[model samples]
Target: MSLVRVLVLEPSELDPVGPLGDWLRDAGAELEIVAPAEGPLPPLGDYDAVVCLGGEMSASDDAVHPWFADVRKLLAEAVSARKPVLGICLGAQLLALATGGQVRAGTRGPEVGPLLVAKRDVAAQDPLFADLPFTPDVMQFHSDEIHVLPPSAELLASSPRYPNQAFRVGACAYALQFHIETTPHVVARWCENSPESAAAARPGDVDDGRLRSVHEDIAETWKPFAERFVRLAARYAGSLPGDPPPPRSLPLV
Candidate 1:
């Protein structure tokens, strides 16, 4: 099989691809990590899949972060072309905003620390989420949230505080408001950099031991999910240009 080529966009220096990079590589993908601020973005056609990582910037702050405009355009183009895409945290908010949804400073305040988000009934039939536990562990650190999903999106998971924890915009595009790619050390650095967000969590929630345990739980649940994503990308990579796209309603498995 041809290697699946994936473009991993890093919108913030603080939020690199992290463990997700290892997961994609181990799953047989060739990845290119790009920071839009450093240079012009490559065309979406160059890769079979795209993964947009989280950032500190608000998704709609195009004026403050000019590179956001190009990033949103790439995400929109990737979805339109039916390329497999994964958007995490701010990436998720950007996906929502780029596709006719809304994003804003979360009314409930920052959602930080390790947490569990319940999978919706719809997720039971989702290609990537179906096999996950009823509630899966995830790391949260964003101050903004996706208030509305894209018109075509299917809600996949939710939390009591944030109902838009996860959603699928199309057959292969997924967005997650939580983080599955962070490690304990990464969380520590994030806490240090954004003490306000860290302070939002309960006193012990962001502690080293708790962060480590939660990351273990997250790895068990989401590593397979990441692998499944690579398989989806590989399927797309193997198709001839003129071939019919995968059925929109069927699970890739």
Candidate 2:
């Protein structure tokens, strides 16, 4: 088969990324990148996987970005097509809304920095997370969180502040509250852009260098998990409802 076509619904103009791009290139996936507010999503054509990256905007911010309205439809199509869909942060919130789940404010506090994901049985042993990094730290920087886990959704991991840190929908689909693609370079930029939010999230102040170091470590720890995710997605490539075959290998490049 040819390269798996992947559609990336970017939340902001910072849509094109090097690390993610490298992975896609190595995975032999033809990537389509687009900003959220650009326009309606072209039908999920020839797409084997769909990825919705993190953004400063909220899933509920439909009034500001008209394109957000079409996100639900696209998400539905991905499921309808049985293509793997992965949502990150804001995208995760949107995924919740798409699957009849609800997302509300994080009552505890904003989760930021290199945090530990508390393992749950459903994720710790599932194909999506099997033999991968367990109890490993992942980079987190978000204000709102998902409260109600979606129907047919399995809770994957949690943090001290947010319970539903990660989840899997319909076996193949995934929604991640934390960031695994946080590169060494993006940390400074994220911290700079999210100064107030970061300050509000952490009781004690964190310096830029320390935050960058933490991000590097978190990104490293989550590598095997991401590899596992990639492998799980491939197994469902020829998937149809009520017919799930054995897992395939998606080894890291």
Best prediction by TM-score: 1
Number of backbone-clashing residue pairs for each candidate, in the order shown = 0, 0
Q: What's the distance in Å from true for residue 76, model 1?
A: 0.7
Q: Candidate 2 residues 1-253, lDDT tens each?
A: 3456678888775433446655655656667887757666767765778888887777777788767768866876666556688888888888877876778877876777667787787765676665546686676778888988877789988776778988887647788897777664565566688886677644432566766677667656555555544544555564323345553332111
C-alpha TM-scores of all predictions = 0.94, 0.85
Compared with the true structure, the alpha-carbon lDDT of candidate 2 equals 0.70
lDDT of every model, 2 decimals = 0.87, 0.70
Identify the leading candidate in terms of lDDT.
1
Give the alpha carbon lDDT tens digit for every residue of 1-96 in model 1: 568899999998889898889988998889999998899999888899999999888888888889888888888877777788999998898888
* Model 2 pairs in collision: none
